[model samples]
Target: MALPTLHYLSHFEPSGYGLSAIAMVRALRNAGYPVRWTPLKRVGYDQVAVMSWPQALTEASHWLRDDESLSDLPALAVVAAVVPLAGAAGFTIAHVAPELLAAVFATAAAESAHFERVAYTTWESDALPVHWLRCFDLCHRLVVPSRFNQAVFAGDLRRPVQVVPHVRRHRTNEFSAPDLVELRSTLDIAPDEFIFYSINQFEPRKNYRALIAAFVQAFSSADKVVLVIKTGSIGWADGPFFEPVQVRQHLQQMLLRMRREIKSDLPKICLIDAANLGGRRMDALHAMGDCYVSLTHGEGFGMGACEAACAGNPVLMTGWGGQLDFLGGDYPGNLPYTLEAAPVWPPERPSFWPSQRWAACSIDGAVQAMQGVVASPDEFRRLALERAESIHMQLSEPSVAAAWATVFAAS
Candidate 1:
């Protein structure tokens, strides 16, 4: 039988989406689906293009309006305005921006006959707009990664959405204890000290500052615990994508400020640039860490958290987004921790920052959790191994491939 041809579209390059897109494409391909990854250029920032169709149009309109050549003229403005309408006509559409609802409605009306099945993945409550409801009305299905996401969509937008847990690419080999030791030695991490690692891009949304603050507060007195942060540099306006220079500078400043605020010497914090770690080195680093920590303010899917868990490291993350879906409901597994149930809003949104409405464990809380694990190293190791085994079974590549097969067949 011929393999089904599935097209995956995005605006940003593949690497930017981190591992979620990587897992999806890998799974689909392994399932005998011929995957076509199309990175759209005729749009604004690539992030929008990766989203559902309506988002792409909305972004494109904003991009055009921002350009001096297109904004002033009435005719050009009208032409620029029609792009989302064209997109709605050609593809499955979901509106993520409230301002673009009218455009989405017009586009949906124009393209109602073209698409067999239109879908939207509501990663959060903010993702659902009134126009998204209109699109949902026209669409055959709505895709969501978690029950929480689906519930928000249903309650807020009053739309029925299907849940498909975020798929992950499986690791090839389990790291041996000896391998872990060697990796620790290579990184110059102490043999006896417990290591907590976090790998993420240096984005404000990642909440790295809070993680650093928490680490300083929690582990500064205990020289036996090391916090190894592996992150690339943050991007600057009109700067190269994924540049590490700016991020390195920022970290230096933050560390200095943190030292002053905490009134303590700098703790053992190692910042690793992803560019410095090749495949073997990356594997070794993952193997070396005793635990993986991610206190992201928000995430569509916590790929790093899942990857860490898969690598036989216990994951310490905020209860948000798809992380909850991966960890299951009864998470932390009776560990001395209180998991908070809350949604993290984007910092860009109004009344988001400084609002303690989200269920993020405070730095003190995370420190307490980390301290419990550190004090009982053997217990932590046992839990880590168990979590790794569970992840291996639950997110096995073959299982994900099977799920993709079903999705493709339906598509």
Candidate 2:
């Protein structure tokens, strides 16, 4: 019998799912599996000698290798072959939704073979959406980033569920002394100013508006504090796409209701479009901040919070969902929260929404947490340091990689 090859399908980009796919590939390869990568969208499998699709990733050129333009990957070895459906021999791992899997399924089915198929996904609701349950039928096993997600999704699943974390190793500070100096200067922020940073798309579930409300309410304009947000995505901006001036204007307008009571001493706020930034730059951004905040309704796994903590920035987050797996049972760095009914995809929209329950954080509690942190920097730093150590230990590279490879190997 031939060796069972590992065929992985996912985007080699920077979003949460994409990052998980990249990390899993690395781990599996490190575990010495014969792995093949299939890019979700267009990919150049050039004959230029590359072993992995993640090797093709370059933010400078829209997910292409630095040395190669996205011509066809001339080498057959670089591109994963569509396995035969009737008698296919290898296992297939898909990081895409079922609707998106139609093409992959068809191509793989064209050949006469059958092999194991596994699916990995991320979700934030208390229960799996009805639309996605059917997709699980196609997979032999389900792998999620958090146990919370596993519970929410496993209610009616046919296969076993497993938790594999998305982990990042400790990074060498990407910014030099001069780079830090220039960065603060460029953002019009002074070294003496205490900075609170948050990065996310302006979506309803992300609840950025709540963070803004709590922020402006917590501190005054006269205070030497700044809320630096790297966010975008407007009326039609699904996520990354940003209209900076317009987006900021929209946020200021959203604050109008509470503005009257803000006493007119609005906190100094800076908004930047989180577009076209590389990994190193992202690391620098996280490292430069005094605290990182992400106030979301729920998360399958709070990737941003994990990254911020790993970067050593104190995090003020909504204490709920999959994050609990590593944030500690009590969620030490998190703010106080309340369990609320599930919300639709767009919190603003009411009628056409999925049924998924999540937590609604108390803005007043957030205000208190913010005040408490600023009042004693040392205390918050200690808390952040403790969390950093705990999270890293739980999600060390070798352990996480081995866990991922185990799941792949099992199938």
Candidate 3:
């Protein structure tokens, strides 16, 4: 008998969900699995052109065509995508939003072929949404990227929840050397000053407000260091850009108010307002920077912090969330957070639990971490180097392939 065909259904867009889906399919096929692929779209597929991820070293790439997967690597196999019926013992695992999970199960109810979960990594929030709690009954297993997320989901889920983390690759590896001159000229970052980098989409959960407030409080214009923030007005995995006008206005107004109240004006903060930085240029930007920081409220896997930590930057993030998967339980760790009623986010996000309370990192804690990087640069470097080495080993292709193979085989 032929090996059962693997039907890989996923969201194919420019966001984290789409990237994670690409990484999974690539890792599995790269591991030598004969897997087939399809798009898990909810609407019209004609108008939009799904982007091929791993955009250029210096730019994000998009092309309109008939192809589904982008990598030059030839596919191992192709298979039919059919719905699976209950008790069919089929295999499949997917990462979908709360609203999509029920629809996914409904698709599986009759055919059962699509019902079998082969195990895939999906995101979980700081709190599980109440309305979707009932959907858990159909799932036998759930794979999340971080322990913090596991705990949050487990509070309501009866199924086994495992932590697989992200299979993120570093773009910094492709660039042979730093392009400091071009980088400085582009961002207006001076040679003498130390650079502190914060790269995130301009959203409420990232805690950009808290980070900027802390940066202004921690250092002044006289200080030779500057905070360089690379941000875009995009929300999360749903993949639509928020209005840059409103995002910019809110940030500027808040910073201005804080500056006025503090009686200081130091144009030391620089913002790269676009989201489409090329991967290589982004890597070089990281290389030129002295440090990276994220005062995020919470994370499903803290991909940004992990990327920075892997790239050998001294990373400062909220002590909680998915970063803990790599940052572990030690110093150079959590920015120290307290669970509080979840703040109302921009219109894009609607799935969090205020009663359960998400993390709100302390401003003092952020100051301590930011200042420590300056005060004892050598110590933080040592720690960052350690994190870089460890994560490099674990997230490497072979290791990730082996992990995925084990899960798929067991499934």
Candidate 4:
């Protein structure tokens, strides 16, 4: 049979959604399935082309409403709609949004006959909205990245769901000693110092402040440990709902206070803003980290953590979401000495969603975790390398390709 043509949609510019779309498309294409990626402009102010008030209002109204013509894309055997489905497009594989299932269902309803399935990655119970049942009723199948996600949607939506763990490519060869030495020197990091890195956007939900606090606290006595944070620059306030500047300012203040209050010889801090890195440099940045950590309050899928793990680094992530499925219990060697609690989100904060409660992790917990890694640097390094090797088999490109082929065939 001729390879099925799949069109993956992404909205944000090179964001988590965009990366996921690219990874999925690349996997499918490599597997001999024809895949095309299309970047759909996010609506509202950030839209590529400026629009008049009337035009913007009209487009918003149409999005809030529905467009039946979206289903008319010919040769499109499947439409893999990432997170937020752009205003009700008619596509066969309507990858419904886990958070916005109702809206996706309404959109998909316009061409119920045209689409055969809906896919989503549900990491938490609350990730899938209550209306998911209604949405699932309209879908012939549901695709999830993990069994945890599958259970969440299957039990709630009362529909059969398939589990396809996120794909990752593992680099088998270890970095040369010279490469490691150069990387450490370039970052002004000591060869003996233990490094804990977190690569995430500077979003409130990422709980970056807690991570920073934890690092400062954990390395209070140690001058041989460093916490390197890689994140994107925060933008101006978009509306009452999204204020990136306010959040960034709050985090900056927190960091300053921590620096003053925490008496660490290492002083524990480095910020690698994503805005500063591009192309090959970005890959090098990720490759240099000794270990990757994420204490996200919520995640559709812990793609960053996975990528880090693939790069032969131990991942210190919240014990939730799709990470649980991908990491599994087979993490080689003993567990890193600490697994911190999730951070708490303050009330009245826009980042706090109604469905989410309790802090993802506290600064104290993060500090303890970092300290543990520093104290036993050799153990952590060995475990990280071993864990990478053990999981490499599962996330291999060929394995992921096979899984994608199965999903496509089923669809």
Candidate 5:
């Protein structure tokens, strides 16, 4: 029998979801499945041109034109789209937010033939919102990225949920020595300074407020330690506050407030505001960090921390969520936290379900985690290096290919 053409649909932009879609396409092709790639055009978000995409994704870009008609999809093809479906028929995998499932169903309903729908979704809380159950009934199958997410959805949905981990594209091994030196020079990072790097949007669940407070409380200017933060706004989802300048202003006001309360010299912070530094440049950025830190309240999959760990940086993360499936239980760099109700920030627009519980990372624990890294940098780096190999192997091309193969086979 001939291999089926995978009709993969996703946004081809700079955000996490966009990159993961590109990774999935690369993996599917490597698994010997012919693919018909389609880009999901969004209102405000701009898709990256095919020529500018990472080298691996460039090969798959030729599979189909961006404006190609999906109405004429091949008979032997299976459709998989992220979030809002593009009105394609047949086996449809909708990678969407739980709240948006109703919209996904509505979009698919426009099609005449019944498409076997699969919801590829995830929730960060121990239990998903009670309201989502009705939406869950619309899908024929459900797929999630982690066991934690699967458990959250399975019992309530009363269905077998498949766990396929996110495909991370890292160029750690490919980064040259000169690339590292140039990146360091570009950032003005000194040789003696120990760097604590973090990459995330200025979102409520990310808990940047806690991370910033802990960093200042943990180290002073005399320690020669700097916190480098890389953040930018997402056009599709992010509000005005997440824009680089606004984020910088928020950080500035925060530090100013901390200075008044603490009355002590504070360490410097370097903020890089860009949509995303993709491919080998991302590797070079990760290579420059002495340690990676995130005090996030919750995560469907902690991509930044995972990428940093894979690149051999000691990760200081709150010990909870989907990340635990990959980061493991006994990882030395795990930080301490208390499980509590998720907070309602920016009261007008809540990022989380306040009734549902998520990790509230201890400020003291974050401080201690940073201090421990400062105390014995070598040991942390050594542990991270040891885990990096296993992470690479676990998420390698063949492993991801096999996982996707299973998903398609069962479909």
Candidate 6:
């Protein structure tokens, strides 16, 4: 029984979509599927943002560059394009916002003939826009990350909507003694100070403003605590890549404003906005954290939080959205939130519309969650360790591969 070669099309950049595509391809290969990858040109960028793939994946298949033709592809090869679809004719998974689906369908349709399209997408809201009903008609099947997303999409489309979560790539290593010392020195922190780390784009829906405010309120300058935010910016022209200097400047201004509002000395905040951070460095960053925090309004699939959990950090997240799929109801770190109208930022091209509702975290709840972690770090770490193994097994490469195989089989 020969496995069909997967003619996968996706971005190779460091953005969420790019990372998810890379993980999906690796999972498929790990499950013994043959793959012939096509690296898609990132929207609004001239050259491919990240030229390198994981070395193990490079060994798995010779990835197709933009100039390279896949005319030689085997007849039986299945196509799975990460969305925007690039006019690919088979399964299309999306990392783009659901609001952009109409445009994606329009562009893809204009470029190529209609082909069997199994579209994988996710949404953060409870309801979709009325116009999306028609756009979804173009896709053969819809796959989402959680039951939350499933219900949202299923309500609008009269098609099968399946839940296939984003894969959780395990963090590479545990903390070595040298690693700990170096991490402390690099960040200029004390050995015993607790670190609450979060990785997210500096976007409105991410709710960074609230998180920063909560952190300041939760712990004072004298507390042995630090908040490390690894962030980037998503530009209209350049897609989801980061500009470290620009992001740093923006964050610094934000911090200054926040400091003035508080009218008090603030706890140390370490901001990391690097785009070229390597895997080992990322693993170290994850390891440095005593707890992973996400005060996000919502997520289609909370990749950063999941990655942090995999790194054995006790996660303190807004108790809503796709993250609940893996974190579960019993997870101790879930922060309470209110169902508020989802915000529409930038106004011109909003990712979410006014009618939709998403979770809004209570600042009090966030502060309390942080306080709990600070009061009993070891206890939380124990719970996190217990949770980590199950999470690692549950969303590992093999697990996600199996899920993908089921979706492909049905399609």
Model 4 lDDT at residue 170:
28
lDDT (10s digit) by residue, model 5, range 315-410: 999998888877899987778899998654434444456677899899998999999998999999899889988888887767887876676668
Model 3 TM-score on a 0 to 1 scale:
0.81
lDDT of 5 at 98: 56
**Candidate 2 lDDT tens digits, 277-311:** 44555666787889988788888888778888877
TM-score of each: 0.68, 0.82, 0.81, 0.71, 0.81, 0.80
Could you give me the TM-score of model 5 versus the true structure? 0.81
Which whole-number lDDT from 0 to 100 does residue 292 have in model 3?
A: 90
Whole-model Cα lDDT of every candidate shown, in order: 0.56, 0.68, 0.64, 0.55, 0.69, 0.69
Q: Please write out the lDDT profile of model 3 over residues 214-306, one tens digit for every residue.
A: 888888888888888877754332113333455556667777888889898754888775444544556666778888988887778876677
Supply the global lDDT for candidate 1.
0.56
Best-matching candidate per TM-score: 2
Ranking by TM-score: 2, 3, 5, 6, 4, 1
Comparing candidate 2 with candidate 5, which one achieves the higher lDDT?
A: 5
- Candidate 5 Cα outliers beyond 4 Å, as residue runs: 1-5, 44-90, 99-115, 170-174, 233-245, 276-280, 345-351
User: How far is 99's C-alpha from truth in model 1 (Å)?
Assistant: 11
Single out the weakest 10-residue window by summed lDDT for candidate 1.
235-244
lDDT score at residue 143, model 3, on the 0-100 scale: 66
Q: Please say which candidate is ahead in TM-score: 2 or 3.
A: 2
